[model samples]
Target: MVDYSILQKKYLVGTYVNRGLTFIAGEGVHLKDATGAAYLDLMSNYGVAIFGHGHPAVVERLTDQVRTLTTLHGSFANDRRAEAARRLTVRCGGGLARVFFSNSGSEANEAALKFAVLATGRRRFVACRRGYHGKTLGALSATDGRKFREAFEPLIWDVVFVPYGDIGALEAAVDDATAGFIVEPILGEGGIIVPETGYLKLASEICRARGALLLVDEVQTGAGRTGPFLASESEGIAYDILTLGKGLAGGIPFGATLVSRDVGERIPRSSHTSTFGGNPLAAAGVLAALDLLDEPMADHVRKVGAYFMAGLEAIGSGEIAAVRGRGLMIGVEVRSRRDDILKKLQDEKILAIPAAENVVRFLPPYVIRESHIDDALAKLAGILSGLSAGSPPPCAAS
Candidate 1:
């Protein structure tokens, strides 16, 4: 077994202060170390492994596609790309027919921002406070988190930030010069914050009224993660442009920006392109993942998420501030030491992620069962008890 800690320190970039674990492999709802100890994966690779690790459907399609055609430049149209586009449009519905494929959620958002620019011929975009879009320059400009964007002080020109769920603030920010209003239907990185009811519909209406495009960033919430093909459907919202990734291809690293036909036509050829985007392998993976999303998977997340959220609330633990989210994209805010609790869960053979601030995020795979939830809760309860007893866990030392 390789102690990756040493090698990681020497070669890997220190962008993330990573959790100290050397996970070797994974299966549905579980990851295994070199010693073959299983850990229930609540994180789901930060919402990428939607069907969980090594899902048969995603695996088979990915394998077959690699043998047939691993990749192709975006210069030519391919069969897989065409089929993938068709499937995505049918799933999204409402005239969102054109797709620009990319390698990740950030790239997808970047594409969407560019589309908004071309379609409106405007420079200004309005994004909500605490919303996360992506890390790229354009997407970063739309993202509201200061930690991610502070280093790159001057981002794209003429971006505005408003309080999420405040219709009046949205009304004030968007105007004639506004090209788009980008938002996450449910904020994932910003503590899994769900907007107030009717907020999305109202925002869409306002954007339309002002001749500005409404762009939804569903990077972490879309593709069955929120018990829907797209999370915006819950609000009956229709976006002029939509960005999706993080389990779009079930961990195979594919993202897409779906735009309205009119908006799509506004952008000229070769305006924006990626060498590795729209490859056959990724397209096949998305096709397979979408097929899986059509089954009991979506239902499973909705049902399980309700049960889990209720259980979290029932615990009534002093350490927990609140539990919020839809479907399986849950976030638990704690006043106590989050890193310590997260490490305790990890030690107990369950994995979770720390989100912005004191938020402990649970983005378990869509295929996660009741047993996994029970196990996670049990471990979490024990840690919470310890924290309440005024004992700091081991990870706090780190």
Candidate 2:
């Protein structure tokens, strides 16, 4: 048998920290490797496979759209695209009257940032430390990690970094020259850190008082990942701009920037455009995803997330520093050996991912049940117990 990993290393760009596992197929909340070994999915492809893999509804809709029209330029209005924009705007109603579609979360955020500058006529912006917007040049300007931005110094715009969840820091940062303040409802890649309640609301109020727009990056926390269509919705925030991606189009690549009428009117024609932004194929996937990601699925995520978090806390291992998250976006902060714990989980046929520095993050599909959580908790308990007993991970000795 050919070594797929070797081939991938030779052919693909070495950007990602590949985990040395190749998945060939996936069902509801589980993935199968080339060897037919089934592993329960917890990271959900970095929170994209919201309805799990190949959901019947998503498959059916995407297949039908594939058989019909797939791509059409924005110059010509397509039925699917129009319906998609309508449904999305109505669903995201916070005076969000328009949408600018793109192919990834980065592009969505880029559009939001550009619109903010256009609307407010200010290039200065405020973002939270450890907040991840995206990696594109414009979005990277607002993203706060030195690792991702140091080499690309002198980014597109001037952005001030403030502490996450700290309203005082945010209020002090925004002024007359600030275009907007971009933040995540829950800092997903920054270790699944959920801000204090009323944080977003207060931030919005501050931005409003300062005449700066509020942009919420919901790429990872939206589409039912955090028990609501958008996490900011729960906070009752009426942001001036909002960005969404990840699972908004099922497994298809998609992104959207929803804007309030005031902000939307300021974005002139041809200011931003993508050839394949609102293609019918992705729009069909969006409709199907919306249908499946209803209140029942969100309720399931909330219940399962609470249960999983409780189980992690009940492990009673000193190695676990804390467990934090909302809905299914959970993070288990460990005292040490975070990578080793992840490898151990992989050895046990469970898949997870890392966040921040020492967090074992879990973005399990909404379909995950208490039983699935139990399976992961069981493996985690064993690993923590072994570590507490001073026994090295089994794979480490090999």
lDDT of 2 by residue, 40-148 (tens): 9998999999888988999999999999999999989999999999999999988899999999999999999999989999999999899998999999998887789
In terms of lDDT, model 1 sits at 0.88
Q: Model 1 segments beyond 4 Å from truth?
A: 391-398
Give the winner by lDDT.
2
Listed in order, each prediction's TM-score against the native is: 0.96, 0.97
lDDT of 1 by residue, 1-398 (tens): 56787789779888877778888899788999888999899998899988889998888899899889978887777999899999898899867978999999999999988899999999899998888888889889988877898999899867999988899999999998999999988888888898888888999999999999999888898898889788788677666899888888767888899998889889999899898888899999888988898757788889999989988888889899999999998999998688988888888988899888899999998888887788788778888987787755558957
Q: Highest TM-score: which candidate?
A: 2
Q: For candidate 2, give the lDDT.
A: 0.92
Q: In candidate 1, what residue range of length 10 has the lowest lDDT sum?
A: 389-398
Q: How does each model score on lDDT?
A: 0.88, 0.92
User: Candidate 2 versus the native: TM-score?
Assistant: 0.97
Off by over 4 Å in 2: 391-398
